[model samples]
Target: MIASMWSLLAERRDFFAQLALEHLAISGVAIAVALVLGGLFGGLMAEHQRMAKPSLALVNFLYTIPSISLLGFLIPFSGVGNVTAVITLTMYALLPMVRATYTGLSNIDPTLIEAARGMGSTDGQTMRRVKLPLALPYVMSGIRSMATMTIALAGIASFIGAGGLGVAIYRGITTNNAAMTMDGSLLTALLALLVDMVLGFVERRVGMRGTEGRATNRRMAATFAAVVVVGALVGVVRALAPATSPAIRVATKPMTEQYVMGYMLKDLIEHDSGLTVELTEGVGGGTSNIEPAMESGEFDIYPEYTGTAWNAVLKKEGAYSEGLFDQLRQEYADRLGFEWLGMYGFNDTYGLVVRREVAERYGISSYSDLAHVAGQLRLGAEYDFFEREDGYRALCDDYGMSFGKTMDLDIGLKYQALAEGQIDAMVVFTTDGQLSTSDAVVLVDDRRFFSSYLCGNVVRSQVLEEHPELRQILSKLDDTITDEDMSAMNHAVEGEGREPEDVAREFLERKGLLQ
Candidate 1:
């Protein structure tokens, strides 16, 4: 595993380099912001006892919120990507920073301050010459803790479209690629350790600087200021960088098929409209996460399922009908400020899957056929599929299936489990890339238990208005990707181990869409 990870890193060295830099920048800015704010707040609260309890309580409360939830909450205000990542990570860093500072400052001897005052020192002089030096170790300790957390949470921020090491980690997990997961995990650990080491050096320097003369202290302070100024400048430039014209952002869920679609859109849009396309793949929460992001202008377009938008985004209940498409488009436009483009000539609905050999041996050609032998077989499914209304419970109840054993497996690992014979059957998507290569058979949904999940582009209406030609550009793909085409494309990536970009381009080129 280690060798494979190292090999993958060597192969994708440039990509990993960019990801590492982004991770560092996001974490660095967040820690810097937290230290400044937390230091001031901690100092004031140390002197003012009454405000300390409530203020510390608030910071502690913010710390308790999960990183993913916090990022989601910040999306509406900060949008997706670096801004939201920095803000959320800063919030996460506050508790440790504030607490450490207050503790350090309060622990200093009152007699030292009295002695400084007796020497005719003013409040500023006393703090700079006596109190601050005494509290330096404690404050530095807090900064150390905050720095570690900022780096770690910055990784999690990748779920919200923030570019960092977390993106690689999540992608590896979703793709069931052990090498990719190891690469991300290893890099993230090294980064955290590196940050800790740097902070430790600074902490030691601050502690030792007390013995130096005024000249030395002045020089050290000046150097620190210069570093801060440069960091701030770099941050401003990144935050304010203008996106190129005729540009649109594309996003996708954390799955092979979604990734394929995202790349396909990037290729087609860039080729047809001569526009710049920035694609952010594997957005967590799928459509639910990406919908708010699109509404907030983080992403201009993404492929979404009509059933998912209805149930997950719009929170509608009950089964869908044939007219669902038109209603969904109208409601999305009128209420959600988005528009639905053409379907991609396929329905990637949920269904049962079993090995072709197993299906033939058991005479289980359909979901209803599974009922006879369910009690003798083990099944695997993803957690989300287990929890969704259209998922496990309804399917079992519809088909009257009661498997002898069931396992809630990671979405990425489920296919491997099924292929290895660890599972007798598993929940499968009709359009999964693995379906073609794994020799798995999708059990017919004879009872029509699952809803139609028509796939298409969901774009911000404002984006369409701004680039009016976008509608035509997107429509070029309408009803072009049939089930067979999707299956082949998926196999090209999952089975043939091809990059989604190459597979998407090859398909588009074959279709003459690149012309």
Candidate 2:
């Protein structure tokens, strides 16, 4: 496994290197802020005994908030991307710094402080010359821990649409690529270790400076200063880098089909319109994040589904049908200033799938058939399925079904769980790559419980007016993709390890939509 990891690293050094720099920039900023804020707060607490308990309690409370929970909580206020990520990391890094400094200052010998005072030292002078110097070791220890934890936590920033090694990890899991997952995990661990080593070396050097000499101390300080300056410069450059770009920005949800379709649009836009397109893949929370970004003009276009627009965007209930398409389109334009274009000609709706043996034994082939045996079977689905308004409960109520047990499974692990008999049935999407080859029976939605989710390109109306010619180019995808084509493309990326762009490019050329 280690050798395979090294081989993967060698194959993708440039990819990992870019993400590593982003991780460092994010973690660095958070650590720097924590150090400053924590130092000030620690100093204040040390000076005031009354302030100590409350300050510690507050940070401790923040520290106890789960990382994912904190991120979800911050999204409405801060929106998405780097700002939310940095705030999350800084909050987590604070507790260590505050406690360390407070402990160090409080533990200082009163006799030593008195001797300095007896020598005609002012209270300020005693703190600066005597107490602070003695507490350096504790502060260093805190910084070391704070820096390490920050680096490790920074990987999660990618999960929320910020760039980092977590992109590789999350994408790998979504694509079912083990090597990619390992590559990301390996990179994060290496980055954390590297930061820990650098801090450890500096802490040791500072500790030994008094015994070593003024000249050695000066050299050590210079080395540390140079490192900090370089890191700060890199971060500043990244934050201030000119985006002077006129490229049309596109975004995608974190799914294999979306990745392929996003690349197809990007490729076709560049090919036919003679315009640049910058595609941002895997935009975290799907419509919840991307829709707001679109409204805010952070993105110009993204692929969306009809039922999602009807239910999630418009807040209308029941299944989408041909009669509702016009209303769906008009409401989007009226309410959100958005336009739907380039219908992909596929129904990527939900399905209830069961192990073939279970279906055969129970004679279950539709929701009605399953309803009779549901109480004897265990059902599994992703977390969202249970929480969605038009999801689990609605379906169960419609079909008058109740499973023996319902398991909340990760989107990726449902199939494995079904195959292992941990679950007798699971929820699936019609175009999921795994469905093409899995030995499972897809039960018909006899009662039409779930809504139709026809896919399309959703564009901001303002962008259409600005680049009127872009409309014609994007329409090339209208009614082009069928369920079979999409399922094959998804399978290529998820099941066969083929790149999404390569699969998309091939399909477009085959359809004569690309040169």
Q: Please, what are the lDDT tens digits per residue for candidate 2 over residues 425-460?
A: 999989999897888999888877888899998999
What is the lDDT of every predicted structure here? 0.83, 0.87
Model 2 pairs whose backbones collide: none
lDDT of 1 by residue, 326-414 (tens): 78788899998999885687778777888878899999988889888999999998766776766777778878989999998866788
Predicted model with the maximum lDDT: 2
Which run of 10 residues does model 1 get worst, by summed lDDT?
A: 205-214
Top of the candidates by TM-score: 2
- For every candidate structure, what is the RMSD over all alpha carbons to the true structure, in angstroms? 3.4, 2.3
Structural RMSD, model 2: 2.3
Model 1, CA-based lDDT: 0.83
